[model samples]
Target: MHKTLDKLYAGIGEAGTGRSGVGELCALAALSANLYTLVCVAPWLDEEYGSAGELRRRIRKVAAALVCRLERETDDLERVRGVNALFVLSNTAAEYEQKMLDLAEPVLGRYEAGRLTAEAALFEAEVCRMMCNCYCLVQDEALAADARTIISGWTAVSPSGTEGLPVGVALARCEAAAAYADYTGDERFRAVRSAGDYGTEEPETICRMLELHLRCGAVSDAEALCDRIEQDAATGTDRTSQVYRLAAKAACELLRIKDAGFSE
Candidate 1:
């Protein structure tokens, strides 16, 4: 469930709200989606708790507040504008079943959608910045590997099996792929394929590929791509270029680590 929450937050963070109204709407939708996630997840908690009904009541109170907030914020927008919002809601709800099974775990092992949704509004302008920092903090060796493995497994699963699963599985897969590529050297893990049925074209996909090249000691290729990406960035406001710049920085870090005689 925390994974779901994190992904939704990440999307809103990526949207960069202060830049445009569309971005703000995306944040609202991301938050609202987390609320909706709680709605579906709370019902199951009824069967799991000693005071199941009471716990559900509390959870619903929070969920209802979130839903009402979303409705108020997004009512003026058309269906197209609400697409990301809807995605957020469904993805959060999808994690409910699995979270129920983890009730006994320490640290609760769940992301609070309700709380995250609330925070999304309070920190709209800097959401993405904070998300990147927060993720960097929590993404240790074990957590990074787990996140990657789960995403790889999720993307590789049959569509038929994923039926009635969260609709945002693709987005989740993308998030996981990004982290996996950064923290681990496993290049087989890719995001969605291209339209040519060739290879992944997702913005983050470029980062993974760049990182993979660096990991394999393909410094020349990585350096060349970095140069090309810098040329693309010169025009300004290119998302792909921004991603490439980050990847290039990572590649440079890898080079330094190697120069320092870091070993496997």
Candidate 2:
């Protein structure tokens, strides 16, 4: 892990000093994405490697360096990706959450009012997902309300046949609704169910729907989803298949606990 971190840091440092050409910017973006994934899975890495504190320190350093490089970036798409990376990093390093939010606010405002380019729409959806995730983590009423407004705006403008909605937009709405449901103890689970009906077979989306079903005491539905996931895993032949298999196992355990009258 340290060797990988060293390589990532060196790449960022080299890119930071170069002229911000497309190649250099692409390098920085790739580094940022790698760091974001590292932060997201930091807990599991810590468990596996047993250097939690030092690993976290290294992650913080790399994230800070990447953010510094991105601060000088001029491209809107790259800037949005940088912000999203920072948001993911902040989840692992909670102290940076407010700082990330402050950074994102202006960018989000620009995208919100801009003409509806594909990039602009993507930015809004990503920001809405960030806001919803933040609200779920911290239980901030204002953030939740703002996220709700963005989601409502999407719904208001969406065609009656939501099947035509872009997959990214639909997934974002599904996640946002799931987050709201999580915060409110299943109050918005119906919204999650509705948003999740866009014909996506994404594993994360399926897992989220399964979890929400459990939250709302829909044991039969959750079991069916769990069975589907397990069946897919059984026939699959990739890393994702293993991930789905583990998720299914965990879901099964959760179901057992629920049936045993244990608090989740």
Candidate 3:
């Protein structure tokens, strides 16, 4: 569930709100998603604490407020955060589900109105992610495709050095690479395939890169990464078992890929 929360929060943090601690609201959304998942998967937690319902209310209220906050945003990145958070927080709600495209258009309009700069291109990638998720929530395949087209172009160039990108940009690219693969599969593997190097080296990032390597017929890279993770795990890398588990998963994936004749 935390994994789900982190994935959802990327879009939110990148574009949740412009106010001070806008990132906190992004966290609020992640908390809500994780809690909701917990409650669904383990109903006892919900019955015992009664926190899930309250958390849900808080997420919805804050997300809606952030959405309203976006109205006055003139800055591209801040508006991106607000807009991204809005849909993520309210995506499961039926009333707000239909508003995705309408909500996204003004931002799209802004992009189409002006030429893409290096800065604008960076933000545009994040915006496309928001659109992709919103469209998936609403089952709007057409708009999702439109967003994917934009994503493909940006992702194809694989920010090899990724300098000047925002702090969370690498994580965002990880998500983008996953999403691109989700939408296009083999036909767009190059566009979606993560470089597997550079950016953040946190366990989560490494886990994702391993997944990408196995995903794109780069099993040897995944195997090599698994060797490193095995050492990290043996070193008692952290309080959590994520790294160890990711190592096991990577090793398993390598075998599976090998058996399936997947290689680069």
Go through the candidates in order and give each one's C-alpha lDDT: 0.35, 0.53, 0.54
Off by over 4 Å in 3: 1-21, 47-49, 115-118, 137-142, 155-167, 180-264
Q: Each candidate: RMSD to true structure?
A: 17.9, 7.6, 8.5
The 10-residue segment of model 2 with minimum total lDDT is: 18-27
TM-score attained by model 1: 0.27
lDDT by residue (1-264, candidate 3, tens digit) is 345334433443323343424444544444454455445555565543235665566466556656655556567766666566566666544455545456667776776677433366557666766766665666567656767677556545653323345545654654555555555452453444344555444554465466556556677787777666666634334422333243344344435434556657
Residue-pair clashes, model 3: 5
The number of the candidate with the highest lDDT is: 3
* Position 12, candidate 2: lDDT: 42
Candidate 2 ranges beyond 4 A from true positions: 1-10, 14-50, 115-118, 133-142, 153-162, 183-186, 193-264
- Flag the better candidate by lDDT, 1 or 2: 2
Per-candidate clashes, comma-separated = 2, 0, 5
Expressed as tens digits, the lDDT of each residue in 154-207 for candidate 2 is 656653213356765555455455556566554633343343344545554565
Q: Rank the candidates by TM-score, best first.
A: 3, 2, 1
> Against the true structure, what is each candidate's TM-score?
0.27, 0.53, 0.57
Report the lDDT of model 1 for residue 163. 28
Candidate 2 clash pair list = none
